[model samples]
Target: MKKGRIILIDDDRDHLRAASDWLTVNGFEVLSFDRADDAFKAIIDQPPDLVLTDLRMPGVDGMTLLSSVVRKCPGLPVILLTAHGDVSLAVEALKRGGEDFIEKPYDAERLVGVLSKAIEKSRMSQEIGRLQRLVVQQDKEVGSIIGDSTAIRSLRQRIAALAQVDIDVLIIGETGTGKELVAQALHYQSHRAPAPFVAINCSALPESIFESEVFGHVKGAFTGALSERQGKFEHATGGTIFLDEIEAMPLPFQAKILRVLQERVVERLGENRLRPVDVRIVAAAKTDLSAEIAAGRFREDLFYRLASVDVRIPPVRERAEDIEQLFRHFASLAARRYGRPEPQVPPSLVVRLLQQEWRGNVREVKARAERFALGLDEEQPQQSAFSIEAPLPERVSHYEARLILAALGINHGNTAQTAADLGIPVRTLNEKIKRYGLRYSGET
Candidate 1:
């Protein structure tokens, strides 16, 4: 391995010689300079991997040299050396972009360790910048969307055409079908692209706070309401509000939303004044709202208002042709995320990926790809002990039940801890336990 080159700058000749000799003996190429000007000149001639400089020096102090090195060779790592009482100045040096700081009479081993870590970090940063540029180029060449399936092609065309319109849009798709990505493409390709593109998930919030969350509320609207809040609609004014899982919104909230859509105005909770909000509504739903409306669960008028322009995204299973492209994209992303050399997907893995039902859609596929990159998905499948396989819904239910049981076990049968771990309310977990007939072994 090639040894890293280091430049040391200090007015103390004995200290420079001692540090330089120590580093050189440890298999580093060290250059020592008593003046900051000479060190900067040497750096300009040939930049070193790292620079160690003292905080105080006669003409052209360490801080001035640090600034010059950063401006000339921004990638170089610089470590500051300071006396015990000058620790504050060393900290200020770090704030000014010094890689790290070491106190005078520092431990030899600790100084070397810090230098090694800083050099490694600098190299990693360079590699990441290079990879990011490549990704940007690839994105430009293939457009923002990563697939070439007929469904995706049609969706892109529809998005392009819809970008010219100012009408409200409703995107219907199962979870993880990239509905938010589609919404982003629409906004970026539209006239409102320069403005804010805010998003919120209707189902992520409870019904009790839904009104104040969707529409702004004044101070003292309710208990614990200490300050006035600008809701999603007000924040998204002059841009777009992408409401995900809109079908999960309560009927009363749906009625209020319908009035907002019709009148282009909203009234803050606990306030009589009405505020006009100019925002294009782009709503998403995991299920068909028409059926929900027929079942009296959703407001018909709100459905019509939101569905003025509708886009249905096909699930990953329906767009099999796009599987290979998506797999490659996700694999690359995972490799970059894990700081590993990009791995190749075997032909067998590709075939298996295409054949899978992918019930969870693109999100599931990406997750599996990440696991594969991490070598966690390399286990061979063993034959089951049972002869019959369960149906999809039955298998899902069985998995859910087992998960809840495991969480309960980990929490030592504490329902509150289990519910918190599972990210569900205690009441909901209790209901599920009762519905599934799950019992604590200790109780019996």
Candidate 2:
């Protein structure tokens, strides 16, 4: 398979041909051009993974080409081929946003290695940027379905479609995977937005008071029924009633719920009349209702009634691309809640987070972000890098600088290796080193 695409520009036809052959042999798809102008046009038309050009051409020299490319395509790598005596000129090119310079008669292996690293670095930066932008754009949308991962986008589309149908929905997901949020999304997006959305925790409700709480009771219905009251179903008339943890619902109550779902009406405990309730039912469960049915803990008929339309939420691990965005959003909200300016998240922290299992899914991420916003590192609570009393942004910067310093030390001051280990681009690492006035052994 071709490793990547490369645009090779050289005024010398022989040199361009030889370089193209070498690169193609190394598994790169080469787009060779002898004119810088043609190469520039090609780059504009379709950007390549990397650009390799001779520094001193007759028209639109490599320096000029490099400038144009940097202006048009911000992160495209441009490596210039320089003659032996033009080391000073090459250094000047580096300052002008050129990625690197290759000495004349360069080793093929060294050139290939440089191009490979550049390509990988560019890819990483672009992916990070794309995910961050996705988080921002989706957060601005309605109903708190915040992510741009394929799983999440598909989930949102499914929710939107279900919202318009005005039918009962069954949402199954792992614990803390936002099943309730899905239920609410369905309710608010439906025609019942003008009415109440009552949520009931089936697992938390006691069986002794289930009837009084769900179907309601009139005066003198029970010992505590001193006055007439509306039950959850009655209160949610013309809206929705969310039954959360439906798998945990008592078996006997499941039949009653199924009866209500089937009949779309409820009878008060003291009355012989059947009251019509025009409310939608949205039930959520973290476990498989089929398994519950097999175990005889849940009623199969109720399961079928509730699952006319089912939605399964993807776990955090299944949509790992959304981790950074989710973490950032949570941190921002936590900061606002705590009356603190949002901390600047370090790239190192993000790298660490993406590697986590996040067994609690979004709930776990939100909790972690709250802790980070409070300037608390749960991993190393005893070894505090900065005081919690300090300004949050300042503390975050200090934490970021410390992480960079440690990574640099671990990589023996090799910026490229340090960047790879920290899961950031070498360019970003170098910028941070300069910003924090850090000393290192191998600068590049």
Candidate 3:
């Protein structure tokens, strides 16, 4: 493998040819020129790993070339070479952003070593800059999907990988599982990030205007078509079009979508000319598309086309351990948005939260958190009715239940630990839990 690409500039033809030949032999790709001006132009046009130029030249000398490179392409390495190697001249070169100074009649091995070091350093700097930009972009794009569960981690990894390759992707998840959010992440992370991200709800659009809305219509295409309008596909050109709830699209329109996807072109309703489109299609489905296809509600061919890549999102229950963190995250956001202090969620309340089934997934959790933050849950007096108006025996039972629930919450539903903390036997606690109809994690 080549060590690095070098732009060698020297007025001395003999020295230039000899150095180029030796460097080439030593696994360096060399572009040798006798004029500094020509070499500077090449550096600007197609940058090399390192620039090796004579300090003394007839026109557009090495000092001028070095200054131009430092001003325009900062961080690029430029090494000055001269037969008249003065200490002051070398110091000046260093001050002017030159990488290093070498006396001409240079030692071949030392020259190769210096060039390699500069190239490696430059490459490292470029790599670090690239990685920093990538980290910021990833955080901005995929950071919205908050969770540390293995499933979420894997989903993020898949999103990151899929974002690099522009292709049609089908995101499969239950309702309120953030399929559209995933599609947005894919669009923002891909090369088409700067372009428009047009999202359309397939189920929301009526069949009568589906084609015109998606493929566009020319001026006077119909009674209401007074102006030339760009459709969703045209608006999303050079970017992505997210078709949410794609399974709900009628079967007849599925054939039209299939044609657009296959041909990468669209014909407006009143126009005969077909305009080519450049877009990455990302479709989402809440239902099992295979079942839809089997029931003849969706086209099998369109399913195959959209499902070039399938990304399945795990429901909230699947990542139950993330519930507490997710709840807190949402509560904090709600607090900020409402300009209210964040509520402190007690351990017992969290236990009750974990007990209920979140049928709506993250969306349900967010709604609950918002209500909690706004103190709406506290307004439900009947919900928290531990009656003091009842008899002593009833009051005592309610107090006992509250203590046990709190203990269980603190111990994270460990019955044995709750029993120990409450100074009761495990069997006694189990009987009480059964009698009171209390929920606990370890109950089998």
Candidate 4:
């Protein structure tokens, strides 16, 4: 294995030599520098695995050098060396991008430990960068969408087919199903690729601000209106405006959006001027708009207008074959973000992942994969239901039973407490205990 390199900078020649010798003996390739300038030059010339610099130097101080290294090589791990009572400066160094700090007159063992951690962190950062670039490259090559499942492939095909056609689109999917991503794929792969892609969440803003947010507002239109502002529609004139959670838009706002769709024009708030706008509308909803219309929450006419080109993204559970592809994609992404090597998703983890009900869908899986990649739970047990060939409900029951028993054990066999913690009634808990025949210590 190639040894990690360390650059140590201190004006004290004896201290530098001692530290270098100690690190070298412990298997690190150490480079010592007496001047801050020399250390910075070495860093720029060939970046080290880790940088250790004294806080105070003769001319160009350690803080300045640390800052320079961080800007030049953001992935480089920098450890600041400060004397006792100068701990505040060390902390400030950390805020300015230094990874850690070692107090002066450092213990040999402590210094080594800190240096080892810094190097590992730096290595991980570098690895994450490499993986992210690979992901970006692969994304471009395979098109922006990230899964290899038949569902995703069909989605890509639809996007490609519809890219040239100028029409309103209605995207329907459950929350966390990457609706915006599909919208972007349409925009990026379309004739409007060069134009802006503006996104708005209809559920995020208040009803009062809806008009001003979607349509430009003139100066003095309302109290506290200091200056004229352009709405998202005006900003997205020649491109695309992605309206997420379109079902949440109130009736009046929906009417305005419908008019924009039909007339290709918008009148700014507090102004009678009708501005002609040429933009593609991609509206997304977590529920069926027709149902909302029937319930009087969404307008029927607006649904027809937006559904000129409708695309439904299936929930993750419905696309079980895509789970592993998505997991690997996220694993690679997380690896890049954390500067760690692309972690292998053990066969067991893949199985557990497939077994998950995934109510939160792809987003939840991405978050879990990220946590796993960061080594938060190295020995996390494989979920039993992931294997498609296995008996699913049986495996799920087995896992659930074990989990309930473990929770009961942790609660010291207190049925009421366990029931409360598990969000079930005491009667239900007692029934389960009997049904599962859970044996507790002190019980026959």
TM-score of each: 0.56, 0.55, 0.55, 0.55
lDDT of 2: 0.86
- Model 3 per-residue lDDT tens digits across residues 218-296: 9999999988888999989999999999999998888988998999999899999999999999999987688898889
Candidate 1, residues 1-444: lDDT per residue as tens digits? 535889999999998899999999877899999999999999999998899999899999999999998889987899999999998888888877899889878899998789888888888888988988686556445446768888999999999999889989999999889898888888878999877889988888898888898897999999988889988899888888898889888887888888889999999999999999999889999877878988999988888889889999999988999988887787666556445467677788888887899888988887777555544456313232223476777766665775676566446589999999999999999999998888655221
| Candidate 1 segments whose C-alpha is farther than 4 A from its true place | 1-143, 379-444
Candidate 1 clash pair list? none
Regions more than 4 Å wrong, model 4: 1-143, 378-444
**lDDT at 244, model 1:** 89
Highest TM-score against the true fold, candidate: 1
Location of the lowest summed lDDT over 10 successive residues in candidate 4? 376-385
Report how far residue 304 has shifted in candidate 1, in Å: 1.1
- Ten residues in sequence with the least summed lDDT for candidate 1: 379-388
Cα distance off (Å), candidate 1, residue 258: 0.4
- The model with the greatest lDDT is 2
Residue 156 lDDT in model 3? 92
Comparison by TM-score, 1 against 2, better one: 1
- lDDT for 366 in candidate 1 is 75
Which lDDT tens digits does candidate 2 get at residues 1-444?
A: 778899999999999999999999999999999999999999999999999999999978999999999989999999999999999999999998999999998998999999888888988888988987676455435329778999999999999999999889899999989998898889778889878889999989999999889999999998878898789899899999999999988888888899899999898889888999999999999976788888999888888888888999999999999998998888777556445566788887888999999999999998787667656655422445557798998888887876676566455578889899889999998998899887743232
Off by over 4 Å in 3: 1-143, 378-444
Worst 10 residues of 3 by lDDT: 377-386
Q: How well does candidate 1 match the true structure, expressed as C-alpha RMSD?
A: 13.0
Give the Cα-based TM-score of candidate 4 against the true structure: 0.55
Candidate no. 1 TM-score: 0.56
